[model samples]
Target chain A: MVAESARENKRVLEVKNLKLHYLTSQGAVKAVDDISFCLNRGETLGIVGESGCGKTTTAVALMMMPSPPGKIVGGQILIEGKDIVPMTETQIRKQIRWEKISMVFQGAMNCLTPVYTIGKQMMETLREHREMAKEEAIARIEKYLAYVGLSRDVLKRYPHELSGGMKQRIVIAMALFLEPKIILCDEPTTALDVVVQAQIINLLKDLKQQLDLSFIFITHDLATEAEVSDRLMVMYGGKIAEIGTNEQIYGKQGPMHPYTQRLLKATPLLHEKVEELAFIPGRPPDLLNPPKGCKFHDRCNVVMDRCKEEEPDLREVEPDHFVSCWRCRES
Target chain B: MSENIFEAKNLQKWFPVRRSITDLLKRRQSYVKAVDGVTFSIRRGEIFGLVGESGCGKTTTGKMLMKLLEPTGGQMLLDGQDVTHITAERLKTYRREVQMVFQDPYASMNPRFRIRDVLEEPLLIHKVGEDHQERLKMVARALTEVRLQPPEEYMERFPHMLSGGQRQRAATARSLILNPKFIVADEPVSMIDLSTRAEILHMMKQVQRELQLTYLYITHDLSTARYFTDTIAVMYLGRIVEMGDPDDVIDHPRHPYTMALIAAVCEPVSGKVNRIKDVPIKGEVPSAQNIPRGCRFHPRCLYAKEECWTQIEPELEIVEGRHWVACRRYKEI
Candidate 1:
């Protein structure tokens, strides 16, 4: 029990049955339905799925802001053993958001104000958080900027003056300014070119090791996810399809879930010569009117009749590996 | 007749930059060298991929071929006939022979029109069909070609009602309604979902094979370029840095830029997950307005030498059989 407690202490964040729903005029859209996962200290967890698969919703939920009409219906978001589900927006801003967990949003480079210099916007973030001297704040900003491989000269330049890669770096630098334990990056390198994307990915990896920061890296790009993530979480229809280590998820044995297996085959690999790439037929499920049973049953190739009637629970298939599939459960 | 269907000799498109007040006072003129000098040829029924980063003139080259943008200089030969300065009736005929599928299917399509109307409009423009009934049959045939099944069900639906993948298929159908011998597809699968990207590519390949149509596939994605195209040309700073078989150019890249691009691709294999990649290249692509005097890629190249920037620009030269590299230090590198 003592050893278990000690191991539990190493966990930075633990989510239990997290459910985020977007209440529409039609009905309540279960964007993130009853999903549970944990992020360990100094570990990078990659959450990957297709568009509208609730990956971004989960990220927003973790940050305690789930846009309008979306709410954390039920669940315990335990950060360092303290539940943050009931925390108010002001409370989250003061104590949790950016102070303990920060986020680098998709296309965040474009979010940088065109009217203001990069330094001015970063300084505003610093000023809003705590009571620090202007000199000290500037010094901190410069330190973080250097961490992201940018010089002090960039501080004087506006967002328009910088390239896409440079702007992304600046956004990453700002994410690190708070020195948060966990950073949520959503498609941070999607808009970038192949070479520039590699540079940014390398920079993020370097920072992750140097700072021992935990990350929730979300992207639809499987290859990029493989490069950075220590653990992989495949989400489909706002539910956990499979969660395992890189080896377990991408190993020769392959993923347990049908969706994951197909998704892996769908991605084109550079090293391997594939005669024909596999593709999942049909579109993603509509959250407003999700299927009766397993969310992926409509598209799953190995789907049984039971899968159309009952959703399977996320069960431990191996040590540190979890799969939510009737086939795996039956096996 | 030669196997080559389309050939471009030193194609160039230089857009004049609006003169600033300072430049106006100084009596200076400048141009954004969008496509300084690009040269390549597409075979009779081969998918020729023009791959590059954003400002590298791949799309501009495609536009020049599509005649969407007129080139400032150079020659374009279609089937051994010079069509560079063709006007009026010849241009319309060129349009009929060479169709273009744009990047965004969502934006390219008219939201107000049904899928049938979208496909039929092209036929009407080219005056390919005799009447509305004949045009409808052509539209159905085109839709069937792209695997949008039953044709009748999808014909009545608006663009907004179709999914992204379906819309892209519809766009492809629209491009094929005219039965063009050549299709200039600019990043056709980039905007679609990951699961559907392969499907769209597969459909396109099947269509290309069935119809024996040539394609000028322009995209920044090297992986898709490798999978989809027979020949690949790596473009850099308004020039063809490398051109060869898709496998040769991608797997055994001769040019430094191509090497960097291949190195940067995050392979999805499980074995390579833990491998830490040292990004071989440095800095983003330079602006086209102020291209370097010698080699444009000298600023970011790891093996760059003094002569790379101070000497005359390198031109495409044969490195191996059917493989070409433009770097002066290709042999040394």
Candidate 2:
């Protein structure tokens, strides 16, 4: 069914049974285990989880930087149905890294070289990935900068001279300069203030519409995920708990996965006033030695005998909505 | 009748920027007016939130309130008595009444010391308890109050042993150990994850009600402010652009800056993606050292007029019931 849907819409990226494990001295830390998803063209899929749930690790693995001590133990990452997991470093660096897919790193404003001018840093990406000449790269940078609301004079200024918002916009412009089909934005507006964060969100939306870009926006903020995402994936202990449209996940169709419901309740939504926020008790399970069955069973309010003994599989409960809870399945 | 427990009358903190050798050669002096003339009051047990983006002096204001940093101008009163320039002997009394909880949970507590020693140090300094047994009881009580139950289990653990949420709760326990009447909680929950934020906030509110403690809740997140604060003051470039009830100020804001801030919050509910139609203000907040002349927010204000440019800076004036705004054309806008 998923493959049929993928063929109907132009699937930009697809991951099947992807597993990433860190070779720690204690044990193999299953950071991302058996996760699968497909991103349609021009669609935004938001991956949200608490810290240590492997959201960022998945982004890093997708970037092809499964560093030493960390390895992709299983599964295929196909970009336009072409598996890039087996591709060598040189092949990935030359053909896949920036030309096909790129990333706007988390806290990326700090990644810019303080000594170099904005133009130089941006030009380096264009010349490296696209192999554009000096004048052409400069012109391209200027145009992209304008698209993100930066002036021409900003090209001459150093990283320290510009504000945080300006620096973030410059980083985004560099990411889109290659015209990549897929962009992995890992918490792009985490450190920025509210109004400035809005600007970056608006800019991303506009650029996505204009370029027909597919995005995997990774954030711990559920509200922000709802703003830009067509579908939302909730991950817990390196496994997906639930995946659905924004409406279905926000209690529109009644009960969801207990973890998802608790998360939506815990998050302070804009303009919504509540007497008290519902907090999910217990810490996220340790990845090194996970629980026997459902990772969230210990913290889940509705845990049953079956939940503690058998792991739930991700199954479609409704149209395009998948959940991994026995209770949800029974309902 | 509600009584004001703490009041700040136009507090100011101006730090002189050290002139570079090259700039000194040109004979120029500059100062970053970090907290310029901020004023607010906390009732006996209500939470007065000081909210703004970074560099807006909310942290500096909290520090000034805690007496950790002395203000360059203005006066502070505790129970109708001036505490700003109180004598050293009297300042000790003020310290007992007012305490602070820092933002970074890891850095706030001494890592080497166990949680028991950390909580007991404040009692030792103020000589609150007569004997070691008494201090231990007080520390255990504080721990239980913060919901770190079976306090004995956590007393011997170091800061590194606890999770971010646990460390923050321990920090809150440390603040409560002093039995302070007022606490300056500076971005206390911003360092923690969303899953743990609600618990910390709920604990804080519970403790406030039980202890009758006033809070100077400082944070950059408006949503948290709305959920936590009774009244909020929105700061912008070293000045408070708006101050009123959190619901009123956040929902029906008069100032353009406040409107922009409310618009910026991303609601998780669907169909509200394009709710914020126009960018109320243009560009990031200007440098505090070079605040615009007429209205500090005018240069970026969408409703800015000719008077907003050439006239003197607008003073904060009350336009409605308990709602104060600093824009000259606030009424018309």
Q: Compared with the true structure, what per-residue lDDT tens digits does model 2 show for residues A1-331?
A: 7668646468888899999999989999999999998888888899999999999989888889988799999999999788999999999998888778999899999999999998888877688777677888888888888888888899899999999999999988888887788999999999999888988888888888887888899999998987888788999999989989777776466338899888888989658788898899889998999999999999999999999999999998887699999998886
Candidate 1 lDDT tens digits, B2-22? 789999999999999999999
The Cα error of candidate 2 at residue B153, in Å, is 0.2
Q: lDDT of each model, Cα atoms only? A: 0.91, 0.88
Candidate 1 residue pairs in clash (backbone atoms < 3 Å): none
Error of 1 at A79 (Å): 1.1
lDDT of 2 by residue, B44-110 (tens): 8899999999999999988888888888999988888888776788878888889998999999999
How accurate locally is residue A280 in candidate 2, as Cα lDDT from 0 to 100?
92
Q: Against the hidden reference, what TM-scores do the models get? A: 0.98, 0.96
lDDT of 1 by residue, A2-72 (tens): 75577688899999999999998999999999999999998889999999999999999999998879989
* Top of the candidates by TM-score: 1
